[model samples]
Target: MLKRIWTIFIRDLTVNMREFMTLYMIIIPLVLAVGINFLSPSINDTSVNLALIENENPEQAAYFDDFANVELFSDEQKVEDRVMSRDSVAGILPKDNGYYIMTQGNEPESVLEYAKLLNVLYEADVQLEDARSEIIEFGRTVPPLKKMLVNMLLLLISMLAGMLIAMNILEEKVDQTVSAINVTPTSRSAFILGKSLTGMAVALFSSIACLLITGFYNVNLGQAALVVFSSTILSLLIGFIQGLNSDDVMEAAGSVKLMFLPMAGSIAGYEFVTGNWQIFFYWSPFYWAYKANDMILSKSGTWPQLILFIGIILAICGAVYALLAPRIARKLQ
Candidate 1:
């Protein structure tokens, strides 16, 4: 049966090669989103046309340097006018000891976007200063700041790969291939493995290729690889299962939007984007994947933690597959 499934896997590849649809489903993403992510310009220019106030202190000015392109304006009104005219992205104005971020919009609201970042940086500088003073200069290496980088990877990974797997399966279903293979004696287990392998192969290959092209970033090799692969396969399998549940290709593709929020939100913890506990995220495979990825990328986790992270996802995938196999078999009957 395993041999047969392997043969079927090869057959799937041949069929995939011959079909422009399958090729398009996988190749288009690689050439587009993933390609663009690596090729796009960096956001290094945090500089903004910022205007400071009369009561500005050196401490505040230091903060602005971290997040904005600081340009001084004499009055808050001038800053407001520039913002209203769309001449500037944001403006910093003075109030008392601190300043207020005045933004110009039809709603006449304040956009502390850049200002808030500056404030955070300034506060960080102050905290660091205090720490330095307190430590009596206790020699310590500053930990590498890996920003919400982990979240971005998880969001991109699960969504992209999940959408692909789901869409591909939905396409196969729409084409009546799922119905065609319903009569196979090798069982639904074999059939699913065959399809799962197809999607996994695409995701795994694309991920590795993308990483290779961009050059590896701040991630531990063995731990990260294991975590990423496990999570990716689980995500792909879940996506495939969801795609199979769809009645048609368009329906399946549209379903990707439904999965987006959960997948992206689930990774919020990986990047610490929101302190709000997304309870729904607990159920998302991508969340676990993101958590696991965080360990590898940050190199802050122990071996047991890494194992549990990767291992649990694999177990979940196995469980989901087992549960699905019986249902698929009954449907075949």
Candidate 2:
């Protein structure tokens, strides 16, 4: 059975490599990761224009001005007018010796821009405090670029695993090859195992390629590989079911778009929402995957944590496969 499965897996993998869509999906993520890495310095160099109003302390004003892209304004009203007129601009005001961020705050991007400004000011203040004080401080946050890259990997792994499996199965289903395989000496378990293994191999290969191309080497290799592999299980199941259910590639492609919701939610919740709001994404498998990736990327991941995540992912996969496998096999037969 293992030998037969290997043969089938190799055949599917070879076919995947030759297929335009499959090859494209594998190449695009690596290209995007490289592009982002090349563009990131420029992106970081792009500064936020901030208006600091009513900051009478010349020492503090000079201190703030020394920070990047901050402009001091004498009149708060003029600052407000400038902010109202300009896009992606924010202002800061003195509040009880601290600072308050001022912005339109209507758009999400504006709110994020304001948050970035506050972070810069807060960091500047922290640097001054560190000079005066002896205490050390740490932040419980991941870098935004790393987080974005993890999310990108999540999308790539999940979509590619799901799409490859679905497309492969869909092709087999269309040609009635599944029924032929079922009737042959190959058991249903062997067939399913072969397909699943093929998808996993491709996903892991592509993920590692992307990681290397992006120069994201600040990660635990063994744990990172496991996390990457575990992350694709959900998508593998999704692809299997969707492929078995759909009549053709068009229907399968449309169905694949629906999985993007969870993928997007994982990134949004991780990057934007925090605290109690984060619990909303606890049920999302990609959420766990992203968190694990974040941990592994940041070099803070533990074996026990990875184990717990692995168990959780396996349970989800087990439940999904248990519920869907029989039906899929029956359909193929």
Candidate 3:
């Protein structure tokens, strides 16, 4: 039975490789991962921008470089040019052993004040060790934007798994091979499992590749994979139902794509809706998956929390499967 399932999976993989859409689904996640990596800012990156004449005061320029985004200019005119440009940049010009803060006047008051404060501290020769402030750590290293984007990408890849299944099923139907499944030695159960393998493989492969490409190497892959695996249940069910009912791959894929509506709602609800309003998203497996993925990516996920999320996802998927099973069976016949 395992061998038969493997053979079916291999055949489906070969067929999917020959199709452009299937290849696009497989490659798109990695491409998006690169984009996300390039766009997402690091956790330590600051929003403050400062322009300095390095030759005028190298000491101040070096000090400010450690705190803000400092741009060095050869003279005061260049510094003024940079500060007056579109971007908000505060210029500190040296005059008679004192410093002058230069801005476009339209720049934010907070930025002007921050530049003044930094100059005041420098003039006072303030030392970090003298302050003796103790720092507390929460151990969260990944930026929130990057974490959210990666989680969304993972969810997308999981749904694409079901789409792959739908495409494979459509191919079989188009070739008039689905009707002959029973006549062959392969059971319906084996055929279903065989068809699912490619989707699962693609989902898992794309997910891992995305994580690695997006600089999530430190994330707990085992915990992340569990969330991804559990979330695929609803999509796979939808894929099978749509694939069985539709006349072509595009129709089946279109129906499967409709699953994104609830997914987007769930993510938005979980992230934005607070207090009692969050209950509205509990029905979606994606909400749980997002929670689990967020915890995992942030390195705060516990085994118990992961298990609870996975259980909820399975429960939701199971309910959906129970409701759709009869329809899928009829279509299969």
Best by lDDT: 3
In candidate 3, how many Å is residue 97 off? 11
Give the TM-score of each candidate. Answer: 0.58, 0.70, 0.86
Model 1: residue 240 alpha-carbon error in angstroms:
3.8
After superposition of all CA atoms, the RMSD between model 3 and the true structure is 3.4
Which regions of candidate 1 are displaced past 4 Å?
Answer: 17-21, 28-155, 175-185, 273-280, 315-325
TM-score of 2: 0.70
* Each model's backbone clash number: 3, 0, 0
Ordered from best to worst lDDT, the candidate numbers read 3, 2, 1
State the TM-score for model 1. 0.58
RMSD of each: 7.8, 7.1, 3.4
Candidate 3, number of clashes: 0
In what order do the candidates fall by TM-score, top score first? 3, 2, 1
Q: lDDT of all predictions, in order shown? A: 0.60, 0.74, 0.87
**Tens-digit lDDT string for candidate 1 (199-242):** 66666666555444433454455565566567766566557666
Clashing pairs in 1: 47-69, 48-68, 48-69
